[model samples]
Structures are given as C-alpha cells and as structure tokens.
Target: MRLILESKFQSLLLNWYSKNARILPWRSKPSLYKTVVSEFMLQQTQVKTMLPYFERWMRLFPSFEALSEANESNVLTAWAGLGYYARAKCLHECARGFVKNPVNSYRQWLNCKGIGDYTAAAIASIAFDEAVAVVDGNVIRVLCRLLSITESFKTKEVALKIIRPIANQFLSKTNPGKYNEALMELGAIVCTKQKPRCEVCPVKSCCKSYQKDTVHLCPHFFQVKRTCCTMQRYWIRDTHAFLLEPSTVGKVFRNTLQGLLELPIMTPQRMSVVGLGKLIFTGKRSIGPKDFIEQIYSPQKQVNSQSLMSLPEFSNCVRVPFDQRQRLACTGPHKRWISKLLQ
Candidate 1:
C-alpha cells in the first residue's frame, strides 16, 4: 500500500506541476551557468529579491570567463548592498576554478567552490534535466509532513534517510527539470510554514498530515532562547576627516570595510565623556586639548558630516551605545542591533 501510494503521489505531483509551474527567467530552458547562479542567489534569500540581482549579474558577467577575469573588489562592490558577502567571494573563486578546467556538465561545475549537495543537485536537475534530488528546507518540510515523521528535522542523518528515497521516487527520467521545480513549488507555495493551504495542495490527497487532519501538528518544531549583548561605538572626527576602522570579527560583516572614517569604539564599562576627553588629549597628541566630545547612543545616526562639522572641536567624538541580539526568526537565525540609530 505504501509503494502504491508513492507511485500515485509522483503522478499527481508531476501532473499538477506541469499545468501550474511558474514561468521564471531561469526556467526557460535554463543552462548550467544560469541555474547555478540562480541556485546560489536563492540560498536563504527570497525569490523576489534574487530576481533583479540575478538578472543584473548575468548581464555583467555573461559567461564563466567574464566572471573569472573580473577583479575581486569589482565582484564585492557589485554585491555590496547584498548581505552575506562571502557568497560573492565564493562565487568568484568558483568562477576561477571553472576557468581552470571548463566543463559543460553540471557535475563538473559542482566540483568548484561553494557548491554543496543541495545546490549541485538543483543545478544538475534544473539545468541539464539530470535525474538528481534536491533536499532543501522547503523539501524537508514537505517530506516530514508527508511521512508523519515526529522526529526532529534538524538532524542531517534523519533528513538524508527520509528525503533520499522520496526524492528518488519523483526524479523524472523524461522531465527531471519540471519534476524538481514542481516539488519545490509545492513546498514553497502550498506546504508553507505558517498556514499550509492543504485544501488546494496538489499532494493533499496522499499527504499523511492531511489524511490525519493534523497538518499544523505533524511537523513538530522547537524554539531556542536568544542572547543579547550591548556594546559601544565611537565616531571620531578630526580637522580633515572622520576616522573609520575595518571590522575584524568573524560572524557579522566579517572583513567588511565599515566605519570608513570614524571613531575609536569604547565599551559601556570604559566609556565616559571626561574619560574620552582625557584619552583624546593625553593618550593621543594628534587630538589637541581643545577637542570636544558628545555622548551619542547610536553612531549610525550621529556621524554625518553636518553633525560632526557643527561641533566645537575639529577633533570631535560621539559615543554610541548599541544592543546586539542573536535569535531565530521566521526566516532563520537573525542578528540585529537595536539602538537610538532608528529613532
């Protein structure tokens, strides 16, 4: 009965997908390069947001050779506003790898930098119509509910064991690209996290959660508490310009050139207006005794040229306090700073 249900499940899903699949730019007979770029861009990012970036990127670097020849800075600059700059760096490295020994196959591209099983399978099946499985977050959610699996979905072992066979069952030899897209689309649109629209779902007829009328309860989830940290920042300014420093931390904005010309950051424990004045006057001879200091709770808001220029001392400093918190949101692990910057 299980085997029979599985056989029928593939047919219903494939048929529904063929009729309802969204017409996307990368899906119009997508090539290996286009598929790879799309897959990379889609990682932990929304499809709507990635659409414009993907289009612009393809225009800038039309081919693998173009990407390989482009400078690292140029690539990073292109990806400036986009968060997670590491992806851009990894992509550049991958392009170089591809140039070293170019291959038309999706498997060959997967061997390059930053390509993992999910990404590789997505590109392989979507671009080349290869019969491969892609087990992403959306796919995982769909599978967990389908099998009525109560175990934690976080474990890699559990995910691989459950998804590999299910993916294999639907991997179409005739139209792998369409089949893969259908599964992803079903997961993204129908089997969503908040409120799954089971009634209209293509796979609802066979879905275990729907059959049991426990669509909301089948996929068990757990939440973790987040920790918050508070820190201070300073935007230092001299006669000519403001001082800025590059971030040395690993997690957020790692290796990014921030605080282009700003102040020396002092923690809450070490911060005082008079103390800062003394440090500037005594510790650094460059800052004259006449240098002025202001208590700024948020550097992002207070460090503009107009604000700094208005101060008495050309060597002006603003102390800003920021509270950084790390937690998981609806999307994923979110790290944000709350301060007077917004107000």
Candidate 2:
C-alpha cells in the first residue's frame, strides 16, 4: 500500500478545505461560546439536523451568562427534539462552570461538565487557536480509509490509539483548526461510507483503501444488537392529559423523553394510575412507522387532581390546560405522540 506523505497530505487537504468548507453559522463568525455549544449539539447529531436548532439556541441564549441564568426547564425546552437531553443538562452545568471562571485551554474544558477530549480539542483549536487534533466519526472514517485501518470502531479506546498519532502527524501545525474541519468535511461529503467520491477527492492519490479497491472495508463497523419490548400505554385526562416528570429511579425511557409528559408506561413496579379508570385506548406502537394504528382515548372518569398529589411519582404532575400544552417541555417520542393527540 502506498502511504501518504505527511507534507503532501496536509497541503492537499488544506487546499481542498479552502474551497469546499461548509458555510455553517458556527464556522462563519466563530466564537468560543458558539463553538462550544455547537460542538455539544453536533455530538451524535448531524450538521443539517442541528443547523436550525443552533440558530434558535444562539438567539435564545447567546452567551455563557444568558445560558447560566436560565433554568433547566427552559434549557431543555429550547433543546427539545434534539434527542440527547443529557447534553442539555451538562451544557447548563458547563455554562455555570464557565461563567464562574472561563476555560481557554483544552485541559480546563476536560474538567468541566460533559466536555470530552474531542470537544476540548475542537474548541481549543477552533476558538482559541491551539495546535491540537480533533477526532470525531468523520475524522476517524477519513483516517481509517486513508491509511487502510480495517478495524472495528466500536471499541473507542483501542481505535483512537491507532488514528490519533496519524491525525497528529498530518495535522497542520499553523492551521490546525482549518485542517481538522477540512478532514471532517472531506469525510462527510467525499469519503462517504456507501460510495466514496474518489474521483473528486483531493487526497485520493494518498488513500490506501482507494488503491487497494477496499474503501468499503476500510473503516470496519460493528452491527448493534437491538432489543424491542412490547409496552402497553394508558392515557388519563382531567382538564389535561397525564404525563410524568423526568426521574432517575425506576424509569425505562431515559433522557429521550425528559421534561415532557408521557403515559405512565412502566416495566413492572412503577407508581402509575393505569387501572384507576376504564381501559379507554388500546393500540400498539411498533418499533417503526411502517404500520401504525392511532387510537385516541377520552377518559369517562375525570382524573381527580386531589389524588395525584398523594403519591411520590404523581407529586410532580401539573394540570396543564389543553390549550397550554405547547408551553410544556416534552422529549421527542412523547412530543410527537402528544402532537398527534392534539391534532
């Protein structure tokens, strides 16, 4: 396999990035706060999906001071439909920590809430102009294919050990920020997993996988085991619908449905008011939307507001008027269900 020389690789990658860099809000007028927030939102999320959310967030809370002063409910509401609720929680904490004493270095960011190595390196290089490498999925794919590292990326620690040094070597010493972004952009747009655009790729001559006719097999992937369970949900309404507050103990749906009201669907021993009323709604929500039957239930017996406050789980329940359901914070899945219910 013909190896890509460091100097030649850096020059071509940077030239390619100069012409093909994505015109993103965070990348356009770059700021420390914006970069940090964008990095957090972009984690496990696509750039296209995060664009509108990023614009909304910047408008809502433009700075560390604004974000730190805001409450968790407001934060989660602004971050709703983003899926990863823990990022909202951690970002809130990070804002608070950053406001107390600003972080300019990667090490300082590491100590802060939810900021991992990749984020730290990205923020440090992009915002602060520090000479460091950022290794994300895009970067990993690019490096693995360029050097032909046909190893599983599921084991993160072991994979990083292989890609990190190569990234450091090819990293632009003077323009590390642009270099990193360029690598990610190349991987995202050109070196795609399904069919790479080798003809248009700037570094195609240096890609070992392209030469070996094994680009598809370069970045090895692990098949994830998915377990699907059958859940029966019951709906109760008084003046409004019934939903539970986010809790750590005895909850199956994690932050996916945080700060929203959902049916009291539990595994076994969760404090729920399912059998308190007649079984008004009966339907099944499969793993996918290929076949879905919608059944709306209007409970005959009005839920007593008095009994809701009696239980620990029901204590956080608030009677959100049907008209004001939009004011409440709900996660993605339950939010869609509620939207469908309201419609």
Task: Please provide, for model 1 over 1-343, each residue's C-alpha lDDT reduced to its tens digit, 9 standing for 90 to 100.
Answer: 8767766777888999888877878878677677777777787567877777788888888877898899875676565444455667778887888778765455775776677777878877777778888887787788778877666655555667677777777566677777778889988888897888888988887888788777777556454333333334443432334432333222233432332113344544324321343221211111111222323332323334445434444234332222211111100100112112222
Return the top candidate by TM-score.
2
Specify the highest-lDDT model's number: 2
Each model's lDDT comes to 0.60, 0.73
lDDT of 1: 0.60
TM-score of 1: 0.71
- Candidate 2 has its poorest 10 consecutive residues by lDDT at 285-294
The TM-scores of all predictions, comma-separated, are 0.71, 0.85
RMSD values, in order shown: 10.2, 4.1
Q: Model 2 off-target regions past 4 Å?
A: 1-4, 152-154, 239-241, 247-261, 266-313
Cα lDDT for residue 205, model 2?
80
